[model samples]
Target: MRRLEGTVALISGAAGGIGAATARRFAAEGAAVVLKDVADPRPQAEELTATGAQAAGVVADDADERGWAA
Candidate 1:
């Protein structure tokens, strides 16, 4: 069994750099990922999904909870 199997992860800063790397690694470990970025998060989410992982993106300002409401 995979270490991250049946787990769900909420990750921020996933549009590039270290966040992007972590997202890939997590998915490879069999975890479902929710990618977040102030900018476009669709690409990263789509990439993970193509690799057979569950992924979704929500555009929001991480500093503001209102953006994440609901």
Candidate 2:
């Protein structure tokens, strides 16, 4: 059984670097991951999905309140 089965994780700056690594790790553990970043994270999300994870990529700026409110 996976540790994060039926769990959800929201990760910021997930388009690259540490955030991307975290996202991958979370997905591998069976968590549905939402990746938020100013840059498009669709490719990374798709990759996770291909590996049998439930994942989504959202483009937004964490520095902007409007970004999170939306």
Candidate 3:
């Protein structure tokens, strides 16, 4: 469907569960995913990236905007 073709998606709370599901969906639709979470997402992100999906994980507390800016 090319729902997210050429889009850059910043997904907050994306370390697992709903957030992770959304990231996967976005990637499947061709969006570049920027995952944000307080926990580490290296393994998940790497797995997704290996599947030809553009994905990267950023560890941060969602309460802080400064973290998002980084």
| Predicted model with the maximum TM-score | 2
> Model 2 segments beyond 4 Å from truth?
none
Candidate 2 vs candidate 3: the TM-score winner is 2
Assess candidate 1 and give its TM-score to the true structure: 0.91
In candidate 1 the C-alpha lDDT for residue 6 amounts to 95
- Backbone clashes in candidate 3 total 0
Colliding pairs, model 2:
none
**Tens-digit lDDT string for candidate 2 (1-70):** 9999999999999999999999999999999999989999889999999998999999999888998677
- Candidate 3 whole-model C-alpha lDDT, 0 to 1: 0.87
Which portions of model 1 show Cα errors greater than 4 Å? none
For each candidate, what is the lDDT? 0.88, 0.95, 0.87
Clashing pairs in 1: none
What would the per-residue lDDT of candidate 1 be over residues 3-58, giving only the tens digit for each residue?
A: 99999998899888888888889999999998889888879999999889999877
What's the TM-score of each model vs. the native? 0.91, 0.95, 0.87
